[model samples]
Structure formats: C-alpha cells, structure tokens
Target: MFFHQDASFEQLSIHRVGNKAQDEFYVLSEQPVPFADDEVLPGLLMQYFMSPFAKVNEVYRFMHPNEDLELNEVYHFTKKFFDGKMDFHSLSEQLAKHLYEVSSHPKIKGGELYVVHLKNVQMEGDSQEAIGIFKSENKETYLKVYPEQGGFQLDYEPEAININKLDKGCIIIKNEEEEGYQVLVVDQTNKSQEAIYWKDEFLKIKIRNDEFNQTGNYLKVVKNFVNEKLEESFEMEKADKIDLLNRSMNYFKEKETFDQEEFEEEVLGNPQAISLFKDYKSNFEDDFDAKFEASFDIADKAVKKMESAYKTVLKLDKNFHIYIHGKREYLEKGYDEEKGRNYYKLYFENES
Candidate 1:
C-alpha cells in the first residue's frame, strides 16, 4: 500500500508484486497481530487487512463528508463473513468479491477496487509471439493485461510545484529512497523534493506565512555550535594548566643564568650598605661559592613560578624557548606542519 497522487481521478493505488501478492498482503498484517491479542495466522490476517481499509475509509469520509457510503455495512458483514479457517488466497477472493458488490453502487464508487481480469490475453493471430503467460515464482500462469496498464505506469508525469521554504511543522524524511518514497507537507501542498522552500510560489502562497514558525530549528543549530566551542575551550584550558607550571620553572632557571651579585648591587642597590654585600661575598668565597649558587637557585625558582603562570594562560609549550634576558622571547610552539620541529620567531617587541 502506497500514498500517491492522481491528477485526473480520485483513486487509491494498490500494487501486488509477484506470485503471492495475496500471501504477501496477509503476511504484512501478521506483523501487527500481537497488538490485537489474536492467534498468529487468522487473527493477524484479519487485523492487517482491515486496519488500513478502515483508515482509508475515515480519510475518504473526511474529504467527502456529504457522500454516504455502504462502507460500514460491508465492514460489519466482512468481519463475521469469514469462511471456516480461511487461508490468504481464500480470504482475498472473498474480500474482493464482497467489496465489489458493496461498492458497485454509483454514489459510493470511491472505495471500490476494480479488478481487470485479462486472463491469457494474446494477439488475435500471434500464437508464436506468446505474450500471454506471466511468470510467477513457482509456476507460469496466463497474463492478465488490462487496458489500464498504460495509465498504471506513467512515462512523463507533470512535476509538482516547488515550495521554497520549510517550516517547523514540515515533516523531514532522511535518506528516503525512490521506491519507498516519502513526501512531506509543509503547507497544503505536498513537498516531494529537498530544495522546496515553503516561502516559494510552488506552495501557492502570496505572502509568506510561518508554518508552526520553524525559525526555532536555526536557533537550535546556533546553540549547538556555541555548546561545542565551549566544550573545546574547557579541554584546552586543562591542557594549558600543565603548560603553565612548566613555564614558571623555566623562567626562574633562565633568570638564574644572570650574575646575581651584579643584579642585586647594580640593578637593585644595597641600601643596608656595601658592607653587608662585602661580608656576603666573602662568605660565599669561603665555601666554594655556595652563597652565590644558593642565591641563583632561589632566583631561578621565583622566575619559574611567574613563567609557569604565563604559560598556563597563554597555552605555550615547555620546549618553546621563553627567555627573559630583559625581554620576553618565544623560540618554538612545538611541531611544524611538515618538518615537525620547526621554530617560530617573535612577532613584536616593546621599545620600552
């Protein structure tokens, strides 16, 4: 069973594939049997066939409320009119006959299924041509070619109007294939393609009207982008913390490379006076320069602490040379695109 459009007439389309179209129809119903709490075969078959028919009847009535149907009478009769322990073929023949009689009335032809019996049809004098028998799975039976076959498969059908916009109420079917085609209705018209926009003239609208205001879909997309970036930033921050501590240690070690006595005396004047400095220098010389080495070590640790903090905030690597010889410098940022360990030069330096 498929939902398709007909421009010329109002009709339902049902196609049976291969030998067991009857068998296949019943089996399709078997899937829904558990819901009805019926025995697998008979109960399943009854529910399967009737449910879609009922829905179609309801839709037909809604579309044509003025028309009276013998649908209810047929439904009641068919429910109890089953043959004893009917099989798929038997039930199908019975249902087909019953429907034909009930819908034979002119006014209620809407629900009628016209069976075109073209058994063993062939050209008048062409026995050797032999186009009559259609091959079924197990056996080859005479073909039933109806005049309606020309109309059954359309060669060039008119294209449906394109709607340029899609609203929130619009149904979206992803990866919809050709044979199992699914269409959406953004407005009153059917949307069969991907490019149709609801705002377009194909929707047969003059002024653009929002169908359930689908602008929320775009807003959701923006929200997702922000959330993803936030997550990435959080991860980068974690990686940066380790970088900071490493840089802090490197900074102080670089600072220690400078002469401590000169840094203290010349850079920072000894106000407690030159006598204290002289005594300190003498104490350092006595113990094989222990005081000088210890002072450098302490300076190195302090500089390392500051450098670590910067590295954390800036996301710099440990191998990246950051020097503070009166000025900050960046030696590397880690791997290059090609060579893997290329260094980068500083972009700028302050004149001050």
Candidate 2:
C-alpha cells in the first residue's frame, strides 16, 4: 500500500455522484465483508484517487454487433464506438448505468467509487500521468485512477495530520460477507510505470503477501536512509551524493534485484562506510516501521522513474552530468600543494 495508517473516512454520501470533476460512486455490499484489521483501506483508497487517468467506470459489451468482449472489461476500448455500432454518448451512458448498477449491486452486495477533486493533490514536480487504479472486492478488481496531471506541485504531505478534502471526493466501502460490520484493508500503491501492465491488462491482479514490492513505501524509507547515511558518513558533496544515487539506480537497472552486499561493494566501496550503512539500515527499519526484501527487485520500467529522483548533475549556469562507472583511479579529489586550492578531477572520454 502507499502508506501505513489505518485511518477512517468521513463525509459519506451514499450513491452520491458528483459532476465529472467530482463524482463519488459507491457499491455497498449486501452482506458484511469481514476483515482482520482496518490498516488497509486508507492507503488503498488514497492510492486510488492518486491515479493520473480516470478509469472508465466499467467494461462495456456491445449488443446488436454481437462482438464478444468479457463482462466487466473496463478500459478505453473506444474502437468499438468508432465502428458506428456504439456512440460515445451511448458508451458513457452504458458505463454510467453499469456503475449505478454496481453502486446498488446485489450479487456482491455493494461497492463504491469516489471521484475526488484532490485538494493539494500534487506529486512535487513529478510528471505523473496516465495513472491506473485497481481495487478488488469479492474477487473482483479493476484499475481505478484519475487520468490526468493538470499541473505538478512540489510540497510534501505531512503525516498524522487530518486532511479533510471530501468536498470534492468520495470513497467506496464494500460491506461483503460480514452480515454486519467489516474491516477494510490497504493493499498497494505504486508510482512506477513498470507495473502499469498489471493495471492495464489484468485488473484483478492478486498481490503476493510474501514478496515485498520494491516501489512501495518501504523503498522510500530506504532511499531516505541511504541519503542520510551517505550525508552523515561520507559528508559527500552534493554532486557526489547525486552520483552515488544515480549509480545505485543504474545498478537496479542492470540487475533487477538489490543485494546488500552487492550494493555496499558497488555503491559504497569503502569498508567503514559500508559498516556505517549497516547501522543506518538497522535504525531505519526500526524508526520508519518499514522493511525491505532480501533482494529488492524493481521492474525495469521503474528504472526511468528512479532517474529523476536519482539524477547526478552539477549546475554551472547550465548543467553537467557526472557519470561514474567504476575506476576510482580515474577520479581525484584533493588539495593541490602548488595551487593551495581544493580540487576535484574526473577522467572520461570527453576529457581524454
């Protein structure tokens, strides 16, 4: 899931559909859906609204055309509409009706969709669009996300702070099988396009509870930990830190999985530094209340995502990227006796 808190939702408007910009639709369960904990729904619901693209409500089936598509196939399958068999208005109506039916669905009881106008809905200078959201209820799931990033913002969201912006949003609480009350669960959140396929093709992808997703909140903690340790121990120059992060990201690109030993050897070659990293990692997990995998593997598509956050550039009015690919022998950082000045030198094809 995107976050860890099992929080509650307010401003419940049952079957309350807002305008296209702010529509809240819910499908309630006729039966109570039982859950072990309530730590799931907040993250799940928030992640849903975090999507960049608006998911077409439901899968459409063509009648009269006799074109056979699976039921509950929700996506931008507008080709059929282009064929003159169904028009856009018809398609919209069809999906809307299907959502309404789902709002009052009987077989699975009830489910909900919240079209939220995300107040302060920002990703801090990220070009995150084409987002997909998926949720599962009673074995049914679909990708749900808002399909647009109108503008980007660069503010960090605070924790333990209550953000009540439901004036332009909604949430779906599915009461399945409980027959009374049900606890909700926050399942997953991803910012990497590497995992976009899961949202696009198989809307009902089952998440493995065992293997941790590298793109989850834990990875963010790990990144922070890495940054802090590097800053504290190496006291690295900003350029050096960025270079290390870029190199680490390159390692993830070259090798999908991350082994601590390998990371230490490749990214932080100094023995004592690696030891410091170990301590930082230990404290990080404890302090952040997050964990990492034995071998953290990221989808290759996510490599591009790491590029922005892990870029290594020295700004001198323009920009210069310092790419360090092994061979510390080619680099120099020391004071020159003759010049009595601090200096840093890098050797590469451009210089050679």
> Which number leads on TM-score?
2
How many clashes (backbone atoms < 3 Å, residues ≥3 apart in a chain or on different chains) does model 1 have? 15
lDDT of each: 0.27, 0.40
Task: Please report the TM-score between candidate 2 and the true structure.
Answer: 0.39
What is the alpha-carbon lDDT for the whole of candidate 1?
0.27
* Number of backbone clashes in candidate 2: 35
Model 2's lDDT to the true fold? 0.40
Candidate 1 segments exceeding 4 Å error: 1-84, 110-352
lDDT of 2 by residue, 223-299 (tens): 66566766665567655665666666667768756677777798778898777767776776676434556576655
Model 1: how large is the Cα RMSD against the reference?
30.8
Q: Report per-prediction Cα RMSD to one decimal.
A: 30.8, 18.6
For model 2 the local lDDT of residue 272 reads 88
Candidate 1, residue 210: how far the Cα is off, in Å: 37
